[model samples]
Target: MVDSIIPKPKRVDGQITGLAGELFVAAELLKRGIQTSITFGNAKAIDLLAYNPDTGRSFTVQVKAIRKKNVFPIAHNKINRAHTYVFVVLNKPGEAVQYFIVPGTTLEEDPDRFTHWFTDPKFPGFNWRVLQDLGHEDAWHVFSEQA
Candidate 1:
């Protein structure tokens, strides 16, 4: 039997998908011995705040999640330079979720990194594969370095 290149995405609400991504990130951080907290709709740009208790450092994170291996929609103007960006691919059932941890400065310094669609000019986004190719998958060390 052959496997599909892109598995069918799980049918889930957008809000739920976003929340799942945030929770998953928080869990991963905690597992790595970092303290994490979810802002839960209070913060406009930040979704998670993580702290390295050992280092006494904290940093903000913004999560963008998609149900499948697709583009993670982002508004160019809303990219916060001080916050880290975690792009998540929530694959089908029984499949492991994938994360691409990228620093916001990367996107801020490079305009070509964003794929701006002519059809939806206002909703420019980053392709999941592109992030993977850039070697950002599971880049958990970013938090350690920042926090």
Candidate 2:
């Protein structure tokens, strides 16, 4: 029923999906009056940079996105403690996008505690569930606090 409620895209493009997620997060941050910019590149670690002029504060964000509700695969070595993470679910056309805002320190502190690592020798990355169980959906206040 949940799957049915959220439609799936007919085709998936990794590049487009990733860019869309970054844009969506940027838009949300802008809506909250936070100045945001997307750092575009294949090798870039930080996707979005947000600043709050009122507080004179700024922070980096790394975005991970999927077309539907599923585990986000990430390399354990890539987690940066100074960056905040935003896991995005870009469901389908007409469906609302879901965002899970989490601090990178939460993952870097103890990755195994929050992610499921693949046992395969070739593909040794971990899958993160995006703190859904912890109720981090739409946690836009994270930026406010950081500010």
Candidate 3:
């Protein structure tokens, strides 16, 4: 067995995969006539920022991507009301990616009970289950909602 402290190659792929997802999100939003741009190098929690020039609807978008077509984990600290999340699944190479757009508040809310999980730091393994359960699959209206 070889001993080396260098991180595995998969780690680098993950970073590129993440950036690919962010680009895909930006492209989709732009295609839909939403003014969108990626935050260079993701210096902030937001990966993309979008605005509907006509209505001035805007969102601070955080994108999460996974190589497999499954829900991805989001760091608990990154959830916020002024934010929207774009979940992406990188399909086969050169194939179109899949996306699920959801609002941050929905991440925290239990619509039936009026409770939330996003603001709770106690939760370490919080996935996008709540947002998924809300049927945000490709739901783009969350952006226009701010208008």
Task: State every prediction's TM-score relative to the real structure.
Answer: 0.83, 0.81, 0.73
- lDDT tens per residue, model 1, 61-108: 899999899888876666778888998998997999999998888777
lDDT (tens digit, per residue) of candidate 2 on 9-88:
67878999999999999999999999999998888868999998767789899998988877676666777889988988
Order the numbered candidates by lDDT, best leading.
Answer: 1, 2, 3
The lDDT of each candidate is 0.83, 0.80, 0.71
The residue pairs that clash in candidate 2, if any, are: none
Tell me the alpha-carbon RMSD of every candidate: 6.4, 6.6, 4.6
Which tens-of-lDDT digit does each residue in 21-130 have in candidate 3?
88888988999899998887645667888899877777788888887654465545556766887788778888877777867776545333212333345653334444
Give the top-scoring candidate (lDDT): 1
Candidate 1 stretches with Cα past 4 Å from truth are: 1-11, 114-120
> Candidate 2 or 3, higher TM-score?
2
lDDT for residue 143 in candidate 2, whole number 0-100: 87
Q: Worst 10-residue stretch by lDDT in candidate 1?
A: 111-120
Cand. 2 TM to true fold: 0.81
Q: List the residue pairs that clash in candidate 3.
A: 108-116
Q: For model 1, what is the error of residue 71's alpha carbon versus the real structure, in angstroms, after optimal superposition?
A: 0.7
Q: Residue 51 in model 2: shift from native, Å? A: 0.3
